[model samples]
Target: MSLDVVVEHSVSLGRLWSEDGLDIMIAPTSVVVADALITWNVNLQWVCDLDYVPDQERPLDLVAFAAPCLWRRRMIAALVAAGREHRVALSSHSVTALQAAIENGLGIGLLPPESVRTGSMRVLKTSAGVPEPLTVQYGLYAHDRRTPVVDAAIDVLLKDIPATPGP
Candidate 1:
């Protein structure tokens, strides 16, 4: 038996899991389906680069994840609430690509702080005219079609993956 891991849009992951194309999926709670057995995970608070100050006078250039990624909606909604006009300067499915774009000063992105690699990247605070992003609930999902190997894999993952962040 072999194991494969894929990272993509949550909805695609959920669809694959429902079809048995994937044995397990770790995705946002919004994608959870009726057939899936879900274990509640952590809430991911998204932040942007510290230098990302929303300019109300101009259209905000955005670095974002491509479509089917539900998290992108949260970013857009937050921008709307802040009354900032926005345009997507760059979009990618890979977090790495998005991070690179942000680092290069292409545009502002609502990113997971954990994904920030460069020292130049700092957390943009709401005080800095940046909108406060919504916290997304993420979880591990599996279905009844699991094999013994799949079950064992799930056990190992649940045991290793922390349900909450460390202090």
Candidate 2:
């Protein structure tokens, strides 16, 4: 029996193929309910620091993870699609670091709504336009030479993971 774990920005089961092996792949979806554009807080002082008036278009300094991360890629694509101009003020690999930057009032960043700590941050809906929400899908791959043990494990995993919602 062989087991392999892969962590990647994209899911590509075809690349994991091996000769004389059948691969069973499972991809779960909608792990994130919503992807929100967030800031430290929405208040008079914070608004004044931004030097912007309400209901107006303005370029914003943005915080994002380093390139090659899917979240960053999606955020950039959303910004371009919305026709909103932005500059990256900070970039880090750590989500905790990114959140700290946002808390320091560095710039706005994208995060799953559930990940946000209540009272420390606020969700912002752009008047210009909002980005499409993000969702996560997990993929599991296994070889076809199924031992009884492997089959049982696979069954448990399939039963444990939540099913994706249908359209």
Candidate 3:
């Protein structure tokens, strides 16, 4: 029998075994860490801006993706652990949407380091209580019955994706 498979993000792997048809899974050895970049509007907070003040403290309006996403979950956990107070100014499922909100001066956002644009926004070294960092894991699931095709596919994937670097 030909096995069907689909690959996507944010899938609930815990429920895979309960399903009838799935036979196998291949996954990352460990979670990948994404450092949050605390970005802000250059125009509003720039050193030369009329409203800017040296060493000023202001309440942070935090922007984040909707719940159930690993990034958002980790961000919240870090904030709670650090005893930081924040208001959720915006919640979105898209990283682009979150970026847009930040660019528009809605609030500071917790985003993947790669997504931050240095040209339009400045990454703050420190915020009121910026969390350490966040990570998310990826996994592949397959049934107990493995075919040659499945084995080959797994082999290819392993070869293509580099192993996670050590701390």
Best by lDDT: 1
Error in Å for residue 26 of model 3: 7.9
Q: Report the lDDT tens digits of candidate 2 across residue range 114-159.
A: 4454456666655434455555444454554667877776677766
TM-score of each: 0.83, 0.58, 0.58
Residue-level lDDT tens digits of model 3 in 1-167: 47566442243433443463345543322321221111121111111112222233554576777866555666666667766666677898787887777777677766555677565555554443465545444444444467888777756655654344222
Q: Candidates ranked by lDDT, best first? A: 1, 2, 3
Model 3: residues with Cα > 4 Å off, grouped in runs: 1-13, 16-58, 140-144, 164-167
| Rank order (by TM-score, best first) | 1, 3, 2
lDDT value, candidate 1, whole model: 0.71
Q: Pick the winner on TM-score between candidates 1 and 2.
A: 1
Best by TM-score: 1
Off by over 4 Å in 1: 35-53, 164-167
Clashes of each: 0, 0, 10
